[model samples]
Target: MAEAQEDEKVGGFLGWIERTGNKLPDPVVIFFYLALVLIAISVVCALAGLTALHPTQVNADGNPLVVMSQSLLSGENIAKFWVEMTKTFSHFHPLGYVLVVMLGAGVAERSGLFGAAMRAALGNAPKVILTPMVALIAMIANHAADAAYVVMIPLAGIMFHAAGRHPIAGIAAAFAGVSGGFSANILPGQLDVLLFGITEIAVEGSQLDPSWTMNVAGNWWFIFVLTFIYLPVIWYVTDKIIEPRLAKTPFSNTASADESVQDPSAKLSSNEKKGLNRAGLALLLVVGVWLVMTFGPGTPLIDEPACPAAVEAEGQCAAVQRLAPFFKSLVGGFMVLFLGAGWAYGSAVGTVKNHRDLVSMMAEGMRDMGYYLVLAFAAAHFVALFNWSNLGLIFAIHGAAGIEASGLPLPIAMGLIVLLSATLNLFVGSASAKWALLAPVLVPMLMLLGVSPEGATAIYRVGDGATNIITPLMVYFPLVLVFARRWSKDFGLGSLTAMMIPYSVWMLVTGLLLVVLWVFLGLDLGPAAPIAYSLPGN
Candidate 1:
């Protein structure tokens, strides 16, 4: 009776969250509402004469330390707002980065390369290792962009059925890895670029060292560890928890062969095999070209300072940095890489017949980004207004002071940030949107606690991603439900949420624990990305 009642209590709680989450406006609408709220707050703060001493402005010509917080309603600021609206949307960092990366990714996805790769991954896997294989591949699919969802989720179901296991189990595991383990990629992908791009803007005037660069590869090592950890989490959840529950109520297949959903048991065509081989060669060639550019002949990608004479005299040029070229080339390099590999595969398979078809595929990728574009328009303006008001920096300063005075150890402080981000994720479904809003305050706030921007962003990803599988507000949640319905008509939102809650809870707990351990151990997050940071004087 106690066990049954406990299960009832769990169901009741998750039902409430699903209902509440569904009632909230779209993430884009929420940002608009928040922007209006921010404007109102800015007005009140400005009228009340609120201000913060600009931390970095202390030595600027011996000027006044106080940065008078400006009102969004102030006439001068109002004029700049209207004038820079277009510029704001265009300059929104994630907007361009995601778009450019998607352009090359579009061809790969549209050309059938991503699907062929998924089949090849699962087609030969031993049933014993299938769960981990799916989980690991899902993490790697982060690079394939939206193909992770469109290709991976359903294919997982199909593959599992062929292996004599419950198909819904595969769906759950793949979804967990794809969405819950979003940041667990072995290499930097579009998400890293998108998040760190915001981190750069967040640190604009807040950082003591103006020369510090926010590398997209900053979380590379940390995420590599996360992928291995999450692999077992998904494997355990799918087998020990999800599959057992599913065994009690086996999945029904009422459809005939003709009605089957894409024939999950079908073999890959010969053309796909050739396309895969060619895609592999194309990827290698692209890497070779980049390596040649990076390490051969004057290290062209290094962007060595034009002031070699000054460097020779002074031993260093203060302004010029070697990494600028490499960082700047990431977007273009990826664009070319995706374009080349995708076009090669598509041409081999005849999905892309000519250059024009490849162009169309790229355009399709842009068209698919329509929703994000809309969100970016609102988000760009919101970020811009916040910067103009200087409220973010003020909040960071006071928040940092408060957290420091609270005397939380560095690991504990980092854990709290992860919890805060996780709580916020329940309401906000867009990862980029959440980071864009939170990074401005959270990045600088943690930097004061001796945490690097990459470290803070890594914490945010743990919370944001862990809850993705369980949240109804996640755009893909409904899609996952539809996939579930394929095998079990009895599955509802409550059922789906309940099934995912364990994975969510476990991922968040273990992910945060790993983060805490990593912070205490002082592990390097990525190339030149440390677990701790110090401001210029500190």
Candidate 2:
């Protein structure tokens, strides 16, 4: 059968989406265009002396700050720009994250481990349950931080292919749950630490209780509820909408339909089953080693606070901060886990006859990243230049201030916090960094209006998670595109963004409603954390 035109098959709004989206330039070129546009914007703003109050930033005397734009064409910056070109590309976080994960992931793929496991367990995984499972797992994967992007996403795509479905749908499902539902994990994690820590700094001189604590799990119950609400939406979009549209368009990057496995539901061979059993053992061994390393020594895997006396006396942390090192170390943990699992399965099944095969497998994985590396370089430049220009910070401050000036109802104000966070998330990809900027403004302002600081923090979480899937400026955005490209090499940035816009919009609207209702119900955000704020005398 001929490859059908995507726009022709999807009628009405979807067709218009496909048509308009496909008209945009390739992702690489688009980044370059964005860089130029950013430079122009930065220069204009700098000339106009447009500035904003830097919320968390302080000077030598520790007063709040006024941040001005950094003009790209200024003599000082223009010279520094040429000097930092190599450093910009090299320092981009996703560049390193993806490359490192692939070092092991590539081995897993080439060693025939993923294939055999798919044959063994893949055939048994119910197609109907796949979307929900991927969505749920992706949401919880925030515990592993950046590893979700590397491990779960590609694994989702492969599983989809084995199950005879569009692999991009699998990527979308995982991406939605992982990035789009980022704040909705059942487990409270370092994200809780990072954001609440900023919240603490935001309230330093406020009139409320000087000793009021900032709990890491303050939003735990709220986010826990959010996870369930998000799961069904992700399932519906991936299964009901995206995949059906995708089925009409053949994946251009992968093997032809006939050349691909026709009977994806084929039963596993006895040997493959045995290999899977060993793979499970290998995975357990990896986890076991990490556990032993964590508890076997004098808390070697976890970092002990230097000021333990001070920490405990503050009545904070909700628990100890000993897991900081372990949390920080998960990136490496994921690498070793994949490397060990792949090697174990490969050895059990004879795919790896010797150590040389492992070496070759690792190399093959890095080799596949050639296109991704180029894309990352351009994206890094775009992001770095944007950061250097300080437009992102200015834009965020402007957005936050606009909502405050609107004098909307408290519920509406909360919703705008979500919206502002979502919008700024596009420009400044770091969750902690953005929160650091907004917390001082949002948390205090909300408190004066009788919205708990925790409540304000929770609303920010909603906004940050909503639009993550749609933004290319997100450090992980290019990484996700590479995941989609594996199944459809012709899939462009616009294609990914277009497919994701529905998810973003739905998540945003649904999330807004959830926040409004949660506040109305006067639910406890977590232990001792309330939906309302109060002043001492009032």
Best by lDDT: 1
Looking at model 1, residue 491 earns an lDDT score of: 72
Estimated TM-score per prediction?
0.93, 0.63
What digit string (tens of lDDT, one per residue) describes model 1 on residues 1-538?
Answer: 5543343332465667766877888878888899999999999989988877655556557863776678999898899999988988898877888898889999988998887888788777789898999888988887776778877888888778878888888888989999999889988888888898788878874644576676777898999999998999999999999989889766865421325345535677888888888989998999898888888998887766654776757855422256666766777788888899899889888999999999999999999999989988888888888888888877887888898888878898888888988888877888898998898889888887788888888999988889988777788888888787778766777777878988898899999999999999989898768878877645
Runs with alpha carbons beyond 4 Å of true place in candidate 2: 1-11, 60-63, 115-122, 125-259, 262-264, 316-321, 408-538
- lDDT per residue for candidate 2 within 142-185, as digits (tens), equals 65555567666776776687677788888899899889999998
Instruction: Locate the minimum summed-lDDT window of 10 residues in model 1.
Output: 255-264
What are the clashing pairs of model 2? none
